[model samples]
Target: MVRRAGHLFAFLVVASTANAQMPPPTVGVIQLEAQAVPRSLVEPGRAMASAEVDIRPRVAGVVTEILYQAGRPVEAGDVLFRIEPSTYEADVRAAEADLAAARAAVKEAEAAVVRSERLLGTGTSQSTLDTARSTLEQARATLQSAEVARDLAQIDLERTSITSPITGIPGFAAVSVGDLVAANQADALATVTQLDPIDVEIWAPSARVLSLIEDISLDRVELAESITATLTLETGRAFEARGSMVATSQSVSETTGSRAARFRFENPRHILLPGMFVRADIVLGTANAILVPQSATEREPDGELTAWVVAEGRAVLRSLQEIGTHAHGWIVTEGVAAGELLAVDGLASLTPGLEVRTVPVELDEYGVVHDLRDAVAAGNVEAE
Candidate 1:
């Protein structure tokens, strides 16, 4: 009886030890909830001027005066520079004098023709009348030629005062006072850039674009009537103004395999400058989707993404159909549902069908996980 009692005691001790060693592993899990998230694509972009015009001379002359200050805003038709107008003025005066002389000659010829017609059958011969008429016609032709010359001279005079063709800020003058410039010169006198409304050019990957199109076709994404874009500067600051999609390339680039998209933004303050680098967030629409923390996912050898999810108190590895990444996680379209517990920690130790002791946890904006109890204690969440 004593030997049997000792044997029973040893059996009980071994069983207790086995039970203590085989307890389920603890894991931190976060419950996923399907919610509307903005379907957005982020791409690197560069800011460009909406309208950039080169200020060039329309007439040839020596620049006499600089009417506009460099780097100043100018309105359309505002005189920017003044060429030497003396030669143009003199040409106009000569043309006017010639026109006046031609007019007088025409009047004399008309009088002679009248006289010849009045006396054609009396004293004036037929040949004489024809000569007077021909002379009158010649005088009239001279008058018309003089009139054209006068108008052209006046146009040249007007062009001597170079004016801005657009409303924008002008750069430094390429020519100083007394510098000679020619009409339609190859070198620009200055550059005027429109800054009130600027353009940002973005190149998005073809794969991303195709995925978006697929999502739209399947009704997974609700397309906005007007797509919106926002920008982040190189300094990590958000641009104050919002933008809209203006145009997109029809063909993808062979080198980069990306399509170019242009967006327009109101830049009343002129904060965005040409050639400035930025990151653009183009929000196409919103969709009801699930976001799985990246830390909870693992990439298999077959190039598939898998995550450990708690199902019926056991770890079940699920394959996720992810479209892209958002915030700090993967934007999953399928293979997960709302109210499912996703294991965020202890993923390496988790195996299929293994019993798991799940503890409620939450991810911060940076995707770092924290225990629910600790979060509550730290006032990060309200106690439930």
Candidate 2:
């Protein structure tokens, strides 16, 4: 019995030694490469109308008709409402009659002056000729005054048709038919807002702006000739239209500590409305950046990001200085370099300086890690 127990103890000792000498854990890794990638900044924004105008009556009168439908598009000079035109029309006609009477009086006074001139050497006295000339001059003055009155009256008549001064979509009418409105009244008949080529106001931190400028100056980032923007709506759908930066505020807001940038986008479908909240991704430029897959990173308790890097056939825990996110990865600016192998899978089992066997892997479009060999065999990815 003692011999059998001793043999069993020896067999257990050999088994424990074999277990300690087992091969290291295998982990899937992807090599890091620096490439020129677009650097984008995302910020919340609001849509605003490029142009807004209030519709108001230019002449005081009772509203006779509303010529436009609420919320419909209107062009410049398009009539929006019709004021009572009968009164204005009558005034124009009266002024025209007065003008005609003034013309007749001027002609009669000139005839009298002619008669006086012809008779000046005979029965007509010199004083009579002078009086006739004075009367003709007075009549001519009256004719000029009457002509001005006629023109003024015509302008008032034209004001009866309330026309939009800009092309835009009109809001609800404030005055209805039979509602009295005053000329140049404080109340607006309606508001017209231009929607197409809408403006989006994006607020970016002033610090970030300074950083970007510094990066450009250092040649680390190549600024795009024209910065472009894209939007994500509140409903989580991507907007179809792409936009460009048009104007930027010169000063930062004291309250928000951010500067506002305006982007213009075509809103032909009227999908973007004034005051609509959205998310804007502004592409400022491209930079040579190292991209690390998000799946490879782990957030530590201290709120720092750490990832596993394979060096000398051992897993090394590295602290990454992530600048921003690109695609399904993070744009790392520090702590890792090009040609380094970053472990993408089996990260939880890894420890500092732990021996690891790295198998090359590739990240799919969605950032899911896949075996390179299997991916290439399935034709999902080309061998590299």
lDDT of 2: 0.92
In the range 194-279, model 2's lDDT, one tens digit per residue, is 99989999999999999889878877678999999999999999999999999999999999999999999999999999999999
Q: Which stretches of candidate 2 lie over 4 Å from their true place?
A: 1-12, 97-148, 299-305, 373-384
Let me know the TM-score candidate 2 reaches against the reference structure. Answer: 0.82
Give TM per candidate. 0.82, 0.82
Model 2 clash pairs are: none
lDDT of 1 by residue, 1-384 (tens): 999999999999999999989979888888899988788999999999999999888899899998888777999999999999999999999999999999999999999999999998899999999999999999999999999999999999999998888899999999999999999999999999998899999999999899899998997888899988999998999999999999999999999999999999999888999999999999989888998888889889998999999998999999998877788888888999999989998888888999988877888999898878776678876532
* Each model's total of backbone clashes: 0, 0
Off by over 4 Å in 1: 1-23, 98-147, 374-384
RMSD of each: 4.6, 4.2
